[model samples]
Target chain A: MSLGGDWYLALAAIVFSIGAFGLLVRRNIIVMFMCVELMLNAANLTFVTFSRMLNDIGGQSLVFFVLVVAAAEVVVGLGIIVAVHRRRAGATADDLHILKG
Target chain B: MTHLVGPLVATTFVDALTFTVAAAIVLAGAVGVVVARNPVHSALMLVMTLFGVAVLFVEQQADFLAAVQVIVYAGAIIVLFLFVIMLLGVDRREVFGRENLRGQRPMAAILVVLGLAGIFLLGFGAHWATGAPSVAGRANAAGPNVAKLGTSVFTTYLLPFEATAALLVIAVVGAVVLVRRTPGARGPDDQDDAGLEEHPGADGGDGTLAFGTGGEASGDADDGDGGERGDLGHDDPALGSTHERKMTS
Candidate 1:
């Protein structure tokens, strides 16, 4: 296939879907976090690809914000995970369900 | 040779190499997260995966995003995860092994296959427009990258930017409260018994009595008359003292 705008966008979409699949199917929370990162990076790829295709800078600009969001997310999410581990003494998500039902 | 390897071949090679490396890293880390017996190892693998994806971002020319990916995802965030793991003391003894996959694996596999197929179909079918209106050249493509980002962050997207700050504050507060000990918290002994799974040979040779009748054997050796018998010696009795005379401590 040619490396056209559509093709690039399609590649990004496929990668994003794969990440989403991993996120849904994986039981491990840390794996889920990795999958989430994959999904975000996929979106960033789409942004950059479109930026190059359309010769625009806005899509690229949005990517920076996305990066910031990802960072903030990691900080808070990892904090929660740490808190959970402290309370439970292990980092398994299965242990978390015990508190619910 | 150089003529034979045209820009197309070169570009294709770069793309393929990038994709292969990125995919392998991601998949390996994902598998590690599931298969690794140690949760700490799994978390580290997750960091590796994040780093891999960041590299892919760089390949795609998302420079700003790549930097964020490294600093926020791999650097600061993974360190936070490490901190939590350390505070919990989850190593050697407390790691939970992988749960056996009874019926979940097959269904998960099927779903993944279907998802991939759907993505392929979407890609092949969509009629994507090529020439969209150019928004800007590429965000922060000039000198002072951070300044460009800062200007855009505060100028057009200030509202969302402020909201992000608020979210960060909440996360900080949440972490502090979650890990904070109470003013009258009990000593280490009084702390709740958590994640104390039975592991063989955890405390090796700590001078504690072993589980057996060995104590009876030693008790018989230290009879009441043994003390008086030692008094008969003219010397300090240190010369004739055997290895058993030394305390385990």
Candidate 2:
């Protein structure tokens, strides 16, 4: 038998927590984006684990959709990053305060 | 074959060992992604995490997703990230010791720890699998993993699948629009125009700056562009008005 679902779930939780912490603390927008990817990966791992636990193909299907969405998100996000970098070289999340009212 | 064993049976030594190793790789890569000073190193660390997740997927009999995780994530996505890092030349080591916001790191650490504890409690406190089994279809049914996944996606989740296609097309178009630069209309005060002459289309012209047409179009429509332009805008109202005047005339 394979390891229990709880073990995988616990690992995923830790990874997700780390991703969230990195997202909150990191100032570099690209690194921040990577952290988001890490969180999404953790969620994907959970879905796959639950798919095994529940014997349902739906969880995996949902993960497939998530993969698509993540690809889209990354593309647009990086495009925006490139555009921003074009205007202002080496600007970090901390440097972005133009929207402050 | 191994999955056929009932969950009640104790896990084999090999299974435990594999899980232990993969989980270690995953956690180490995750921490590396967070702590790496250079963005390039962070991207490489992300690849390690993705590979570890892929191994876990295979362990869970998600064979197709394991392959997809490797191909799409490790192959395409991380490469794209690296390309951007190299292209933008932002791979320089960042000073991690400096804290722009006081107490931000400590607060984030506390919040993440509390949230993680809550998730663990909630996950383990009750019966983890409360829902009916195989409501969609049996994942471990006798067939190839790809076939089962494809059948489910095409049959039960067809609408969502189609929507994802649309989403992908929109993303491609949005990316192109965002990165496209308008020729002529270089800002005289803009200091970073040193390399602008390299692009064949970017002929130097009047001092009027062609602010991102992507930003302007998004600002006008207020669609998904607001989120992309969250950090972008002319801070000075006078410069903004001048941009507007230049655009109109």
Q: Which regions in candidate 2 have their CA more than 4 angstroms from the true location?
A: B1-9, B184-249
Put down candidate 1 lDDT per residue, B107-217, tens digits, no spaces: 766787787787667656764656654444444366554565566667767788788788778867876776564545433522332211121133343422221112221
Q: For candidate 2, lDDT tens digit of each residue in A1-101?
A: 67988789889999999999999988888999999999999999999988887889999999999999999999999999988766655667876785375
lDDT of 1 by residue, A1-101 (tens): 11344545555665676667666656556556656876777677777766655555666678877776777677677667655543443334555665663
TM-score of each: 0.63, 0.81
Cα RMSD for candidates in order: 13.4, 9.9
User: Each candidate's DockQ score against the native complex?
Assistant: 0.24, 0.51
Best by lDDT: 2
Q: TM-score of predicted model 2?
A: 0.81
